[model samples]
Target chain A: MSQILVEALAKTYRVAERAPGLSGALSGLVRRRWREVHALAGVSFSLEAGELLAFIGPNGAGKSTTVKILSGILRPTSGRVEVGGLVPYEDRIRHVARIGVVFGQRSQLWWDLPVLDGFDLLADIYRVEPARYRKRRDELVSMLRLEPLLAQPVRQLSLGQRMRAEFAAALLHDPQILFLDEPTIGLDAPSKLAVREFVRRLNREQGVTVLLTTHDMHDVEALAERVIVIGHGRVLTDSPFASLRSGVFAERRLHVDFAGPAPEITMPGVTVRSRDEGSLELAFNPADIPAPQLIAAITAQHAVDDIHVDEVAIEEVIARFYDLHDAREA
Target chain B: MAPLRPYLAAFRARFQLLLEYRVAALAGFATQLWWGGIRIMVFAAFYGAHAAAAPISLADAITYVWLGQALLALQPWSADPEIGHAVRTGGVGYDSLRPLDAYGFWYARSLGWMLARALPRAVLMVLFAGFVLPLVGLGEWAWRPPSSLEAALLFIPAFVLMAALAAAVLMLANIVVAATLNERGVNSILTPVVIVFSGSMLPLNFYPKAWQSWLHLQPLAGIVDVPFRIYFADLHGGAALQGLALQAGWTLVLVAIGRLAMARMMRRLEMQGG
Candidate 1:
């Protein structure tokens, strides 16, 4: 059986609506209108143990809603969600004990307490035995480079520092599954890399099942083995990262810097994307004509200064994907 | 022991964090002293007007006023501020992630916040009103000691129950705030109700005779009037036990209601951000 299974999950929210003026506000006091929002519309997916899956979507795409449901924070309107053989919402206490969650926009640590004290409180909250807690605390402290940060109050730490402390706080109990919602949001380049590296190590070395939702495509490229692209509360694609990339756009770009004025390339599968005085850009499908053969055909007839092939940017692919499905936030 | 560890830890951490706000404690003590002085003068005038017809003696009235000021923070004047802030900012979602009973966790923290804020002021009020007034030859106006040895002994458990009852009441307020997603309406309504019914504004005895029994039996009375009455031995013997029972009963009832409300609210909770 899959370690995490969500079948036909649906969550609808009744939002109170009102009109735009004082008269509307006064009338709203007497009678209110409510609109139902379908946050999750029959979404289904499953993850085996130790699998790292990246859940990517635009804003308001129900990514966080799904994570909240799976983590037992919110009960879905209708669905079956089981984590480690326990229904997440029904058996919350038992299920939550086995999963660690970090919502990067929020801090779990007490703002006024020192980082170490917050960790101690979490240790007790999770009821880890004293000796085992000490070992785990020391390991996480060193791993996240939180030793120097232990004495500083959480309010005083920078965003990067606090995020590291949050990661340690969430994992202090050695949970089997970790759910990270936009864990690298608002982080600098180095901090983002550090977060990615730590998550990768935790997933690979510790064999921890990780479900990450992020807008950072680099996070998906670097950490996730499988990707699930969700849009409008529905999973659009679930496959290996490479396959998703290929499936979305198979056309690769080749930029060539010719030794002389660029020559026209008239291949069956290739088209000239752009032509400049001393350079040429061509788009081609590798399946139609292999890169090596195309390169050989080019060099065989013309002098080539430099040539390199590049895949489309991941951000562009996701934007195009969102467009294809009309999944942009309303 | 293991099951209770999380609540205990939450309590201790909040207690320690709140204790660090020494300035707030000092400011509160000063404010309470000002109010205590005004209330004592008002009672002295009222007693002078009808000395023989008064329900209690002026000295006991003075002590009750001092005690009310000293422990005013124990009243469930509003929901826990941290919980209110969490509800507004959507941080309340993080609270549900913990593998513990939600009501118990919040109740522990509320108890800690109340006690920590009340303790220093209580000690300071005792030092000034109990000792300094007597040393300065104004003993009649001072906060007197418990009326008898038995009253002193019973006051201990009463005090503990008072804290529990306050936390329970505050938990209900917190649930309301969570359900409404706004603290202003509940808090504005709660403050006046708590002030009047908790006997902080005036002892229940001072109220009209017809309303006396109902006032004494109400839950907020356990927070102030019952406990303070026990301290003065006014509700002694079987009556004192009744007061303690009232405190305990109300605490349990409020906690039960709070637990139910919290469960219902959490089921429908929708965290509004990604």
Candidate 2:
């Protein structure tokens, strides 16, 4: 059985609506109008133990809503969600004990308390035995390089520092599964790499199942083995990262820096994407013409100074996929 | 022990954090002193005008005023500000992630905040009003000790129950804030109601005689008038036990209601933003 299973999940929210002025406000007070928003519409997915999956989509795509439901924070309107043989929302307290969650935009630590104090509070909250807690606390502290940060209050830490602390806080109980919602949002390049590295190690070395929702394509490329692209409250694609990339856009690019003025390419399966002073950017489908064949064709006809072949960036691939499905934010 | 650890840890952490605000405690003590003085003078004037017809002696009224001033923070003046902020910012979602009962977690923290703010001021008020006034040749105006040994003994449990009742009431206010997504409406309504019915503004006995029984039985009365009256032996013996029972009963009732409301609200809680 899958460690986490969500089938035909649906959630609807009733939002009160009002008009634009004081009169509208007064009329709203007398009689209100409510509109229903379907945050999740029959979404389904399942994950095995130790699987690392990335949920990616544009804004308002219901990724976070799904994470909330799986973590037992929000009850789905209609669905069957089971984690480790227990329904998430029904057996919330027990289910939560087995999973860790980090919402990057929110801090679980008390703002006024030192980082270590927050850890101690969490240890007690989880009711970890004192001896086991000490070992776990020390391990996380050293793993996250939180020794110097232990004494500083959470409000004083920089965003990167606080995010590290949040990761440690979530993992102190040694949960079997971890949920990260935009965990690298607003982080710098180095911080993003660090977060990715830590998550990878936790998943690979410790064998903890990871379900992450992120907008950073690099996060998906570096960490996730499987990718689920969700939009319009439904899963658009779920496959291996390599397959998703190829399935979305098979076109690869070859940039050739010719020794002289760039020659126009008049190939059957290739097109000139851009012409620069001394370089030509050519796009081709590897299935139609292999990269080596295309590179050989370009060099044979022209004196090539520098030549390289590269796949399209993941961001562009995802954007094109969304466009193909018309899944841009409404 | 294991089951209660989370709530106890929450309570201890909040209590310790709040106690660190020494300057806020000093400022609150000063404000309470000023108000206590004004209320004492008003009572003295009223007693002078109606010495024979008053329900209680002026000395007892003075003691009542001082107790009210000292423990003024014990009143459920507003929902816990932290809970209010969390509800507004969508941080309350974190509370749901914890492997603990949400109501018990919040109740522990609220109890901690109330006691930490009240204890220091109560100690300071006792030293100044109960000791300094008598030393400075103002014996008649000083906050007197409990009327008898038994009164003093009974006041201990009464005081503990008072804190429990206040925390329970504050939990209801917090649920309202969470449900409505705004604290201002509930706070404005709660503050005045707590003030008048708790007898922080005036003695419950001083209210119209016809309303005295109703006022004495109300929940807020356990927070202020019942306990303070117990300290002065006005509600002694069987009356004191009844007052304690009223405090216990109200705490249980409010806690049950709060738990139900919290469960219902959380079922449909829609965190505001991504």
Evaluated on the second chain alone, the candidates' TM-scores are 0.98, 0.98
Write one digit per residue (lDDT tens) for candidate 2, span B1-274.
7779999999999999999999999999999999999999999888889899888999999999999999999999998999989998988899999999999999999999999999999999999999999999999999999999999999999999999999999999999999988999999999999999999999899899899879999999999999999999999999999999999999999999999999999886887556
Separate clash counts for every candidate? 0, 0
Best by DockQ: 2
| Pairs that collide, model 1 | none
DockQ of each: 0.79, 0.81
Per-prediction TM-score: 0.92, 0.93
> DockQ (C-alpha) of model 1?
0.79
Could you tell me the TM-score of candidate 1?
0.92
Kindly report the docking quality category of candidate 2: high
Ten-residue region with minimum lDDT total, candidate 2 chain A: A242-251
lDDT tens readout by residue for model 2, A69-117: 8998988899899999988889999999999999989999999999999
Candidate 1 regions exceeding 4 Å error are A22-31, A249-315, A322-330
Clashing pairs in 2: none
lDDT of 2 at B178: 92
